[model samples]
Target: MKRSVLKFGGSSVADFPKIKDISLYLKERIEKGEQLIVVVSAMGKTTDNLLASVHDLTDNPNDKDLAMLLTTGEQQTISFLSLVLNDIGVRAKPLTGYQAGIETIGKHLKSKISSIKGDLLENLFEEHDLLIVAGFQGFNKEGELTTLGRGGSDTTAVAIASAMQCPCEIYTDVTGVYSTDPRIFPEAKRWDQISFEEMMEMSALGAGVLETRSVELANNHNIPIYLGKTLSDEKGTWIVPNDQILERKAVTGVALDKEMAHITITYPSHDRQFLSDLFKLLEDAEINVDMISQIQNQDGQQFSFTFKESDEKELIRLFNALKETYPDLYFKIETTYCKVSVIGAGMRDMTGVASKIFKTLLDADITFYQVTTSEISVSYVVDEANGEKATRLLCQTFNL
Candidate 1:
């Protein structure tokens, strides 16, 4: 029998009725003799509510305790989903990540999947039973429960597929991946298929459809992913592993982020020691910097460095460290900005891509702060308020 892993997002199981619909879908597939492993996230807004409650009680809740509390959300979801499956005459069982033998390495909030002991799942598969595993929560060697930050469900599903050596399918509110966020661009088109590299860029830059880490795992394992709507029969986006057959669309998608800050530091000399110190400080503060740039003068006597807003606090700490160390270098930090990118696998071979991208924004009179690129993508930092407009124009220009 062919085995597969099915994962449902929070929206897919947002309420009782939606759960019933998904359960029916699973039941139909099971009746047809497909061995399945189902993974599910917390119900709609459960995680948000839990976070709110934690914040209300304390400004900074303990990470381990918070993870323990949040994992319960998925437990509730999978348990209810299991009951709904049985209610429809489908024999199903719910297992928490620990019960399913999912083990992780990190401390609490940002744990990574370390290992999975599949003894229980293998036995259940031998019995020809459908296994429903809670999506995100897992235990460490210390037996402490942990959560896989935001987007954990997607990671959970893909990890399970890798462990089980089967393909995985994801069900969400949208039928499939779109050229851009459909809510922002009403005309955003859906791709019949997308490559793993392109999908990773989209997921990293704000593609809401799937978690970036999950895509990474799928790419590593050469697993195919199916994205379908929970209520519709329409075939969704297929993430393909083989690049040989993958077609390159000049503009596969557009991604945007409004929460960012920009910081730049100029120094009389491009002191390697000072730069190393700044990076170490940011690392100590656990700040993630994006789109960093550095340049030196013709004489190589002075240097300029710039980075994104998400690293503001860390940058500030680094800035102070530089002041203490050099006492002469200057730093200028600013916030209230946005970053938008046009992503496509075809960009790797496409010429004049940046020119076309900029012309679209120029036609709309959109002023951008800075621009950067990867082999497969180009991104611009712009005014925060114009984020939606920027996304719409790129979506239209590329006919995404």
Candidate 2:
């Protein structure tokens, strides 16, 4: 029998009706001689509601306790899906991360998956052709429940597929990946096929169609992933290796990351030791720092970096530690900003792509605060309000 792992996002299995529909869909597929493993996220907005409740009690909820609480969302989904499948006469078994033998090691809120029980899964498959597994939640060595951060379910599904050596299918609200967020611009064009490299860049830059880590893992393992709308026969995009495709667009996509914060620090003098120590501190704190810039002169040195807003509280706490030593150290931090990125593989061999990007934004009178570039990408930090405008403008300019 052909075996594959499939994942459905929250919106797809938001309620009993949708869950039943998906169960029936899988039943038909199973009857057609295919073995399946289904991964599910929390029901629609369940995780958000749980988060609101946690923050309602305290701003600094304990990570261990938070992990315990949040993982129930996916567990609820798995059991409910299992019930639906069973009621419809399908041999389905629901498994949580621990029950499914998924182990991880990292912070409770953002754990990295370390292992999966492929032999156990295949053994279970002998009796039941279908296994419904909870997504986004895994257990650490300490036996504590851990989540893979937001959009982690995508990673879970991909990891399981990698273990099984099969192509993975991810179904979400969108029919497929787009050049930009369709909600921001309804005219955003969708791609029939995208390279894993381009997909990773888009996810990291805030396409949000799939988790960045999932794409990275799939890329590393040479796994192909199919993204499409759930419960629909619509043709979707295929994410494959770069060498599989012959043509490359100059600018394939534009992404706007709204969860970014900009922080700038000014030191009294250029101190290499202090810089190294601060970076080490950030690393210890697991701060996701990006686009660091530094300037030095006879007077002092200025340092700037961007990180997700979710880490702002931890970052502030870290800064407090530095205050006792460098009382005169100055820093400016702002959360009301977003990063707009232009990405394409063709930029590696094509020239002037950056020129057209900046010129387009400048002609629109949108002032960007910071700019960073890579071989195949250029990103700019701009006011949050202008993020949509910049995305639309750039997508149009690039004909994305």
Candidate 3:
């Protein structure tokens, strides 16, 4: 069977009309001999509205109850889409994450998918060519409903594709992957294909097209991902292995992330153990940190790192409590920072990439708060005000 896993974002299934359009599109695909496993997110602003209702009820809602309530969003999507598909004479089965055997283990709000029983999916596929599964949710060992955190829908789609060993096609609002966000670079060209490693770096560094974990899952499972606009004729972008990439540019893309906070923590002593203890707390709190730089200050050791700006409130609470133990510890967080990164597999053999980036920022009189590099990417944290300008300049210079 020419089978594939397909995912539609919240916008793609926003209402009955959109869902109907998707059904028509799927009918054509099925007629062309493609069997599909479809995944869908909540309708437009559904998750947000649901969250708002909960927040109105209580400022600090229990994560377990929140997970149970929030998952209803995806459940509604799956129910609606399946009804439309079935009404259109296409055999469809709507399955929740639990019904589909997506067992996850972790905290209630941001659980990690631990295993999926492929037999359940296989059984459904035998009766219906279209199996609609709710994204971003699953069940834990105790049979409690759990939700995956941000970008969880993307993770759900890719994980299923990996389990089935099939290509995954993600339909969204955009046409394809661009050299940079088109809002930032109107002239940015869309790539026909991108390497998995490059895509992963771009996603992590800044591009919001695909989540890092999803791309990483696709890469490890050797599952190709095609990103395209929903119900469009455009072929979109293909993410695959490095050797499968037809062209390798010096710098394929530049991404700008505005939702990052920079933190500088200074301790009173050269205590590496302090660093360990601090990071342990961060890990336990499930904070995703990046671009860490450890430096030696005149008095002691200083560490600078960047994390999601959304985590600022939680981090403040964490640091405030830590201060009780170490009265002299100094920690300052600046939320108005943007992380800009240039990503390309070609950079593996390329030099002067960093120099070019630094010179571009210098000529623009933009100061980089921090800098980090890898085999194929370079990231810089700059004032949020200069982020778009710096990204545009680098995009132009790199011909991205």
Best by TM-score: 2
Q: 124-223 in candidate 3: lDDT tens per residue? A: 7778989999999999999999988888999999999999989999999999899999998899999999999999999998799998889999989999
RMSD of each: 3.1, 1.2, 1.4
Order the candidates by lDDT, highest first.
Answer: 2, 3, 1
The clash count of every prediction, one per candidate, is 1, 0, 0
Candidate 2 positional error at 152, Å: 0.6
lDDT of each: 0.83, 0.92, 0.91
Per residue, candidate 2 scores C-alpha lDDT tens digits across 263-308 of 9999887778779878888988888889889888888999999999
Model 2 has an lDDT value of 0.92
What stretches of model 2 exceed 4 Å from their correct place? none
TM-score, every prediction:
0.89, 0.97, 0.97
